[model samples]
Target: MQTLTGKTALITGAGKGLGKAVALALAAEGLHLGLIGRTQKDLEEVARQAKKANAGIEVHIKVADTGIYAQVKEAVSELVGLLGSVDVLINNAGILKVGSIVELPVEEWQQVIQVNLLGAYYVIHEVFPHMLAQKKGDVINVASTAGLKGAANMSAYGASKAALINLSESLMYEGRKSNIRVTTLNPSTVATDMTVNAKFTDGNVEKVLQPEDLAQLVVYQLKLPQRAFVKEVGLWSTNP
Candidate 1:
């Protein structure tokens, strides 16, 4: 199995939800972390938890909106300076805009696209060179199963994820020569503030997929053999 003990990972949306879970998991595995998010409090809390989980885990928190290219570029630059190399970039920052197409505000739709699609692009744009330079890395985009199909009342979110899925595939092929692995994680429904508040998943998270469950899968992919990689994987609950 590949060892991630001394590797560095940058996780967007690391303030909360699945991003936080993945950060803590990776920290436990001894990876230094660069946490990017909009909230200082949330990011700090996560950083604290990471330190508690692994005292040796180095953590750097940046307040940046992934939707903005300039912020992402600056944040990534600073993180790379601190950590030296970003061996993993987790593009997990996203938002939920649930409503009918016609009735939904245009700004809301745009916000979703900005954060969900362009956000991933911005981070990937900033981090790709490091991966290329190092000759090894992984980029994990946390998308949704909705991206694979047209769903009712999910125009902005679904479309953004769909574009992200395609982007992930394109990156996967482009980075193969440099030993970079790109993967898209399409989860049906996970217990997070985004899902629970939207009334999309069940209220009882114990019955459904949790953030830690998805984090496990992310770590599994990261631990795979160097010559092998998973292009895409979807998670679904038996009853939800």
Candidate 2:
């Protein structure tokens, strides 16, 4: 296993849910953190927890909406300034608008794409140059099982996650020579606010995958040896 001491990680949507859990887990391993989220209060809370885990570790919080390119650029710049250099980038900001293609509004679909797909792109684009210059970095993109399999009433959300998977693959190809690793994590039915109200085809909320479990998996990946890279991991609950 590799140690995370002296490393810095930037995680988007880190104010709550899986992002928050991952931040705490990384901090436990001695990684400094940059928490990016729209909610200032939530970001502060996560930062507090992360600092508690590692007293010497630095924590930088930035309130930025990942869907906006300018905001994402500014946030990345601020994070780099505060933490020196970002060693790991976690693209976890996304939204779910469950609707069939026939009934889904164009605006709603666009909003999902903007946040889920384009948002990841904006972050990666801003951070990749620095990673390339450094010749070493890690990117972990939080996708969904919808990216691998199409489900009913998930046109927008599924399409966006699928795009993220493709983007991660493309990034891996580009960064191979530079020793930068790109990983895509596809999980099903994580128990978060986003999934709490989500109804399946049978009108039941699937609560099999928890945020902490997802966080543990991400931390495990980060602990792997530098020469060993798990490019893509697909996780699903047995009950789901």
Candidate 3:
């Protein structure tokens, strides 16, 4: 197993939920962290916790909306300068707007696509050169089960995630020669703020996935050997 002791990881949506869990998990393994989120306070809290775990580890926080290309580019540039280079990139920032196709507003649809799909592209584009220069890196896209299977009232969210899955596949093709590993995780019903308000068919939340479990998987993938790559993995609660 490859150790993460000296690596630096850049994670988006690091304020809470799956992102925060994954950040802390990587920190536990002695990885430096570069956290990006829309809220400075949340990012700082995560950084504080990470620093407490490993005092020698470097932590950088950037408050930039991933939806904007210029901001994403600028943030990545600054992060590379601060952390030397990002050894791992996690695209975890996402939004959900549930509505049937006929009832979905155009703006809502666009917003979902903008944040979930275009945002991933922006980050990948900005970070690709750095990974190429280093000739090795890990890119994990936090997709959803909605990406693989359509659901009622999830047209917008599902479409965006599906695009991400395809994007990750394409990235693997382009980055394989450079020794960059691109993996996508499709988790079903993670228990987060995003899912707390979601309208479940039977209002059954107990069967949903847990952020900590997903975090464990993220850390496990990070530790995998360079010769092997799990391109895409789907996770669902057995009870769900």
Candidate 4:
């Protein structure tokens, strides 16, 4: 396994759930964290906890909407300046709108696409140049199992994630020669507010895949040998 110590990773949606968990795990390995989230309070809280995990670990928090190009561009530029360079980019920010197509508000559907699909695009667009310039980096998009197929009341969310998976695939082929790894992870039944709302799981987090479970997997993927990388992977809850 490769050592990630002293590297830099930027994670979107880092305030809660898998984002927060991943940030902490990365901190444990001594990677400086550049966290992007919608809520400043949550971002600060995560940063605080991350600092506690390793006293010398650096945490930079940026409040920006990844769905917005201007915000993402500005936020990423500033973060890169703070951290020097981004070794890994995790596009984990997404929204779930669980309702029938007919019943779901048009605005909500648009919002889902904006945040889930467009958001990932904007972040990748901003960070790819850096990875390309360096000829080495990792880009992990946290998609969903729902994206793999059509499911009940998942029109907007499913469509967004499906597009994200395609996006990851295209980037994987496009960037592989440059030695930048682009991967997509589709996790099922994670015990987060999003999954609980979808009624796929409950508050008993341990009975299903927890946020840290998904977070740890992403870290493991990042540590693989430079000569080998998984293009895409999926996670499912065995008990669920």
Cα lDDT of model 1 by residue, 90-165, tens digit:
9999999998899889999999999999999999999999999989999999999999998889999999999999
Better of 3 and 4 by lDDT: 4
Give the TM-score (vs. native) of candidate 1.
0.98
Per-residue lDDT of 1-240 in model 4, one digit per residue for the tens? 999999999999999989999999999999999999999999999999999999987899999999899999999999999999999999999999889999999999999999999999999999999999999999999999889999879999999999999999999998999999988999988888777776767566668899999888988998999877989899987885
The TM-score measured for candidate 2 stands at 0.95
Candidate 2 residue pairs in backbone clash:
none
Q: Give each model a TM-score.
A: 0.98, 0.95, 0.96, 0.98
Q: Taking the tens digit of each residue's C-alpha lDDT, what string does model 3 give over 8-47?
A: 9999999998999998888889998999999999999999
For 49-89, candidate 2 gives per-residue lDDT tens digits of 99998898999999999999999999999999889998999
Clashing pairs in 1: none
RMSD versus native structure for model 4: 1.0
Query: Which candidate, 3 or 4, has the higher TM-score?
Result: 4
Q: What is the C-alpha RMSD of each candidate to the true structure, in Å?
A: 0.8, 1.8, 1.4, 1.0
Clash number by candidate, in order:
0, 0, 0, 0
Comparing 1 with 4 on lDDT, the higher-scoring candidate is 1
True-vs-predicted CA distance for residue 197, candidate 2, Å: 2.0
Worst 10 residues of 3 by lDDT: 198-207
